[model samples]
Target: MNRPTLLVSALWLALAATAHAETAADASADANAEANELERIQVTATRSERAIGDVPNTVDVIDRERMETLLVRDLKDLFRYEPGISVGSSFGRFGLGDIRVRGLGGNRVRIQTDGIPVSDAFSIGSFSNANRNFVDLDTLKRVEVVRGPTSSLYGSDALGGVVSFITKDPSDYLEEGKDAYFGFKIGYDSSWDGLFGGATAAFGGERWSGLVAVSHRQGQETENQGEVGGTGSARTQPNPQDLDGRSVLAKLVLETSENQRFKLTVEGNEDDTDTDMLTSRGRQALTGAINDSVIARDHQSRARVSFGHEMDAIDAGFADRLDWQVYRQDSQTTQYTREIRSGLAPPTLRDMREREFDFDQRAYGLQANFGKDFSTGSAQHALSYGLDVSRTETRQKRDGLRTFLVTGATTPVMSPDVFPVRDFPISKTTTAALYVQDEISFADGAFRLIPAVRVDRYELKPQADNIFTEDNPGVALSDISETSVSPKLGAVWHFNEDWSLFGGYSRGFRSPPYNDVNIGFTNAAFGYTAIANPDLKPETSDGLEAGLRFSSAAAYASLSAYYNRYDDFIESMRFIGFNDDGLMVYQSQNIAEAKIYGLEWKAGLELGALSDKWNGWSLRGAAAWSRGEGRGPEEVEVSPGVVEERQVTRNLDTVDPLTATLGIAYDRENWGAELAGRFVGRKDRVSDSSLYQQAGYGVLDLYAHWAFAPGATVNMGVFNLADRKYSEAGDVPLVNGTSTLLDRYTSPGRNFAVSLSVNW
Candidate 1:
């Protein structure tokens, strides 16, 4: 990073503060009274408490109460009822259940928790799991989904949209003046023959308050439902896989004064998965049996501490306010795969890919913002300046073995000696960023504007070559430095009680995966073996969006559109060897251009003519459409001459076309019933020339809950009711036949689950 260049950018931004002295805000609804303005408490789309109808963008809010009744176990489960969102073909079984917002799908979007960026270090996560899984829905207060890129406000990877889950505060755990409370729950599922339990407690007194929660769940997979003459079923093996997991979460706060406070949060999460999977596709023989292995054994722990003095004076100047936070994390996971096939050439097949990893990351950040009431100035404005520095270091050691089909040639063509072995030196990356944001309001309250800028410097280093064993030498590597300056500009107008408009544009970019930063490969089975090329560049994008809002306490609607233009995109090219282990490997390359465009819509309604007892019933929905194309060197014409003729696909075709959901719920007295359905669009998502596409499908899920008492409740739900037939998105064409298919996973049939809870 060039220090002089960065300083110049910061100076220019600082001067703009004096020129554009307009009051800025996230949204007006956040500052309003939640109890009085039930219409404005939206967590998604925008930050402030603006009604969905009054904002120009698309946002879908899943209130905390709804989650209690739904009994969701994973993040994908949360999208089943949200508008303009759909579960991708991966079926949410793994994190691969890509989420499509406003036509943009997969990792193009961003995921956050309580305002902090979530991890996406894996091979470009769209709907795939990460170092740690998403937080449980039960622990969340509300979910906010903004349907387009706002990378200017944030930095890096904010392409399609951003989804943030906000957790509840200490106040939510207390009962009036009570100092402590407790709750317990247990659940059972038929599909997985699962068992679940949870407990929570809260305490508050004098200047301190805290809440603690713990939970566990165990599950067994359902038996196969398909009847390929029970030939392909391979029922002779283990019919059910098992999983066990536990988690602990806590939040503590100390209040020193009315305007000063301190808060701390800690969480430990871990899960063990024993899964039985099959390699049955369209052309593969049913003779190949299903595989069994300990799919995942993951554990993670994290802690965050922050202190703030709301309104304080610093030395001789009125410093407005100050806040500082520090964070740390430790996590590990070991994944293994084994074949339990029946009639293959090699009756017994076993392959194990093991990774023992340890990483530590820390952040030190500070923020100071001045309050603006206009009483002392002609224009009311608040300005915030902050500095953030982070450092993360990780060590990785992976061991793997893949089994191949042995023809009548008994020589064992690809033996272990020359087969595949992967080991990479420990890699580390560090970053330092500085930023400033300001908001100004004019004409007392009619107009609001926000302008912000951030500058970041990153350093990447790879350990020097060393001997791992007596005769083996580690590979040599290089270090890299990256710098970027991002900016945003936005404005909003309150035309009247029923009309308003908003427009904004943000720039975002993503550094390539750390693993790909330095390494290349020659012999790799499931992972890149070793072909280190430290010259790859980061992908950048400039995105813009416009929206409209209209609202009433009882009803509201929103419509929005956005476009993201990308540059120097990192892509994968087919420059490789044969797949001795069934899976294909590609040499990653860089592309010059690509663009994604989308539209989003969402609305809500509260009934007025119905009985007062049913006044809580509401109707809400959202839908989105997106399309993208490649325009650089990667887009050159090609011919495969087979089942596939010619088509267009940008990098991974995981992008879904259109996803939508419409549902109505009745929150009557103590009983609630919700009928929700989710849809997934089809796409030829393969990065290969064949461009195999999966047809789109939808599934209906029904849930009901009853509050038996102040501290007790029951929830029952049916998943995939009506036994829909579908697969999560992975698919490819047959060897010689055009219409024939291969290797696609089908979602499970209808299943029921019930849970009971008690609290005090």
Candidate 2:
């Protein structure tokens, strides 16, 4: 069917299925029940416990049931059917990618697990961890996403949005009256030729509880269905990743009193990947470098330990609750490569070359929050205040060794390396922040207003590790400091029990990262040298959002719009022949101003509410459209020894295409199934660059779940049901502003997966 026809048919099916399922009175009762259940779902969107529906913001929650039903294998799987968020995996690699929200990504968004942040942001060459893949999906019970600037409460790194993963606790597994429980799960994915298995055990007593979980996975490389250039071509995208991963989680909880508790959690995860990097199609197409053999072994791991305490009753005046947590985390990624090349006429390397690189970030943090409830005349108020402090130390190292031999020479000699690979130095950053927020309800709960503010201080100290440059000159890395203040205001008007209108305005900020500020590099091959930029300013954003929401026994829907403005955007500028050094100079500077706006709509219907005969049937859909434009730095040589830097206004390359997802589902006690379609609109407004323009496409998927007996279930999914070869919008490889190989980064072809799980 056509796009419009398909959408109309979907609506008709939803109404018809529900119309014959139940009577009006039955539907009303069902609506009430659903509303009640929704009210019980609590969230931390405002830094305090509140019902999901009561929060004056746009948020998405993926609970454990949904996670298990979908048989999620990675973080990207969680957002496959949701709008406003897109997950993109790096080309030629298995796991490294990014999660973009509302045209912003990378360091603009913040990721957290149980209120503890992960690693710092740093990307070099083809290797990156921008997706926050360090967390173990097996141990997670839920994932929450809040879109838009939240720096008023989260301090920083929340310019685009926030993603929080809630892990499984002992209380989640134990029965109402039972004190202990254990379970295991096994899954397989044909696309990656993967196998995964996990087990969990938990127990709780009168005053103490504990839980432990372990999971492991092994997978071969992922396959692509398209040729190198998307047409009849002999070359195709290379697939050479072989991966193994393991994760462990342990927690302990003690109830000091009826109104107090203490908890400790320790979690660790590791991933090892073996791949042929230099021989990949993208690499070969980039520089015409043919490879005899190129092998890369990369490892990534993360470990975190956190201690927390909570009390409902505190002695502080008017304070009804107190919460505190202290945590220490270590995240690291290391890569070792061995390659040999000889096919080229002038070979870069005819023998073996071995290289090692390491990037590590260690963090320690402390957070405390207190909540109070009171009344002021005709308004009831809930106030929350908190203090946060954190210190992070980042270190990087690299060493390259090569062995070469002439065609007639028998012995290969180790040669001295001339060019340096990694130029970033060890850096330490300390951040301290204080924040406060208050939720006030007036007009007898008909109107609610939330006001919040946060102030932060950041100190950056480089280790003076870049004392000697590639030119054998001594240079000093300066220390930098910055301060930022963010504020937010939101209000919700409840016209009646079934409908509400809400809006919010907030400010966000992002400090310059160590890699960007203290970058030191000299590429002789490219005739360029990059020095540190200690005068960079922090980026800031101001956003306004408004939305309307309505819910009934049989259906629920929301419509929202937002506009955001950013200033002092950091961008890299390259200037040639502007100085006496006689080499091109590159530096990061605050050089841009931008504005972005978008509209979003989501709706869901329950067929069971229409008639008893159509019980367990439902329909749901979501759509988002966003566009942004900003001024970026560009350098042009006006005359000899004279170059001018200009700020050009253009569409941002990070903005994703308009996207939507529609699904029909049937869920019951014994069996469940769903059919979904994802659609993308063409992206042409971006700059006339090969990397930004993308075409529109659509794909279908099917999923099913069956419960054979108590606690025994089987889930299966068929993705890309029609085997259509289409690429996701904005998913492309960046080959350093060169190379025209854009079609090598498409999504995987048709794939199937099945999972068997049991709980007791």
Candidate 3:
């Protein structure tokens, strides 16, 4: 049978069995009752404690239970079922990728941990990847995603949205009435072809608390069954990878007095990956009739330290709570590559090359906030104000060497001169911001309003190295400073107990990072030179959103739509002008205006409410659709003077295809199982310069959890149950300047994973 037919058949069989299977009715009823006692979920995405529904914005929360149930091993695994989001593997699974939201991605999104930014956004030679995957999932308590502009809370890098990961504390580990706890878990994954394990210990006391966690993982190459480049005749080989990592977390909390507390947190991670480059994308040295080998070793490390204090004992009448924090984060990535090529005729090594690239970044910041709550006649008000200051520094270096093996002798291929492949000098950026937000409720909490504003000042300075400056004597270093204000206004009306309406308008901005402002390179082989522009302006966004939510004991649903406009879009622009090297030059410039709009919806239903027979079953689903276009400068020579015109509507590359997820879950007192289907629609809309398009595909996953014994449990997941081979939207990009897809980078197909965990 065909793939689709088999999928339908399997689904039918599973549904039939679930519907007719004999189960303990009384047991199922009790399970339904237990599930109905849902706890209120609070989120810190808004920089304040608020229930999920109270926030006048689109927010999604994934708790520890869901993470385990879904067998989440990494960022990609966690976001598989999330709508309007796509994680791109531009480089490879190890590094060089980004996460997209709505129709924007890359540096537009801000990723944080415990309200502090994590990794630095830096890419050169397309080697930079989103540094989000280094964190161990076993240490995370929950993750929250706030969709859309959030500059009113976070200063910059909030143009698309914010993804915040909160780690576990002593309280999360200690059971009720318990002062100390110890837990450990070990698991394996078929896709990764590896084993993983972690352990945690926590102690809680009246005045002091402490927790420590350690995790380690090692795995082989990820599996992929799809054809090379989505074609039958594969010209390039596929590369296999070796991966391993370790993570450590430590936190301490001290209560100095009643209503006053202080916390110190330290987290660190180290990951190393080895890849066979001959079969990797864009690294194949021999197309046919020859044997070649290329190996790449990538090492990444991250560490962060934070100290914070929270106090509510202030006697000042205008303030009820105050909090302040200081943090420092450091991230580094280094890659070493070696390649050897041999001719089929003699099967002897003929050429060899070695290359290395290093990128490092550090950030230090301080933040403080104050909150006040009061009530007037018939009205309630809550106000929060905060200030943030941070300084960031980055450095990049690259070196390469090539040799030819002839007659059992090695000969150098280049002149004896110092050359840097990626020669970006040290760059620094300092940012300062102050923001305030106020929430007001009227008509006995029936109607609410939120108004917020933030002002930010940014300074960018470039420190050129002697090696770079000496090579190009005419090159000049410059500094830039910019300031902007972001504002947000929102309103919500609770018409009844189970239904509410909300709408909001917000503004966001993204200041150009050091790389964008001072990036410099000259490639004589490519006949091009690219230089950064100090005059480049920051990217700004204006978004308007409206939605309605319905909530009850048996069902919950939400529908939202958003429209966003972006100005001063940053993009690479080429000018056919002669430089000192007499080569065409490319410059980073702000040359476009764009618009994006999308719709999102989520719903869940408890079948038990309909009848006693269906009490243990529930249905949950989510869907998202987005579209965007951009306008760029187009100049035309007229009869007299030149005329500038905007080009026709051009599709944006960041927009993901229409996607949806549907699932059915059955729960018992000690065990539960879920079956889910994720569908991705065809994406024929290609950007102006894009040469590839992604076909539609669907995947069905089965997950089950069982506590067979006291303090012990097992979890199982069957991903891509149909074994349908496919590729992620942005994973398989078309060959640059051509319509043919590349010969690598396809999503894995048909994998099974099982994990065992014991807690005490």
**TM-scores of the models, in the given order?**
0.77, 0.90, 0.88
**lDDT digits (tens) for residues 1-760 of candidate 3:** 1433433343344333323332322224444333321223645545777766677888888888788888888878888898887787643435435777886877789888888887665554433342555567778999888889889889789999988889988878777688888878888999879799988899988889999999999998776663443212252224567898999999999988889999999999888998865333233343443335667898888899999999976888868999999999998888787766555346454666666778887999999999988888888988899999999887777666666566555533333224463355588889999999988999988898999999999998888887566544455566889998999998888898756888899999999766666656665666766676889899999999998776555655677789999999887544636787777877778888999987777766666765687867887777787888988866555557866564656887778878889999998778999999999988767674455666788999999999999878899999999888787775765455353334355666788888888877
Query: At residue 411, what lDDT does model 2 achieve?
Result: 28
Q: Using alpha carbons, what is the TM-score of model 3?
A: 0.88
Please list the residue runs of candidate 2 whose C-alpha ends up more than 4 Å from where it truly belongs after superposition: 1-23, 27-42, 127-131, 227-234, 281-290, 343-349, 405-422, 466-472, 523-527, 635-645, 689-692, 734-743
Error of 3 at 374 (Å): 1.6
**lDDT of each structure?**
0.56, 0.77, 0.76
Best by the lDDT measure = 2
Between prediction 2 and prediction 3, the one with superior TM-score is 2
lDDT of each residue in 1-760, candidate 2, tens digit only: 1433444444445434434433344554644443222343545578877765677778888788788877788866788877778776766554555777888887788888998877755666543342367888889998888898889988778988888888999889877899999889999998789999999999999999999999999998776674653211233564567889999999999988889999999999999998866334222564454556667888889999999999988777858999899999999988787766555555534555667767788999999998998999999999999999999998876666666534533222233234344456678999999999999999988899999999999999987543235422444476789999999999988887767889999999998888778776655555667777889888999999998776666766677789999999887544434336666777777878999888777767776666677677777788887888988777768899997887678887677777889888887678989999998878766665644456688999899999999989999999999887766653664332344455466677899999998988
Q: What lDDT is reached at residue 171 by model 1?
A: 64
Instruction: Enumerate clash totals for all models, in the order shown.
Output: 39, 8, 3
Candidate 1 worst ten-residue window by lDDT: 18-27
How does residue 358 of candidate 3 score in lDDT? Answer: 80
- Give the range of the ten consecutive residues with the poorest summed lDDT in model 3: 18-27
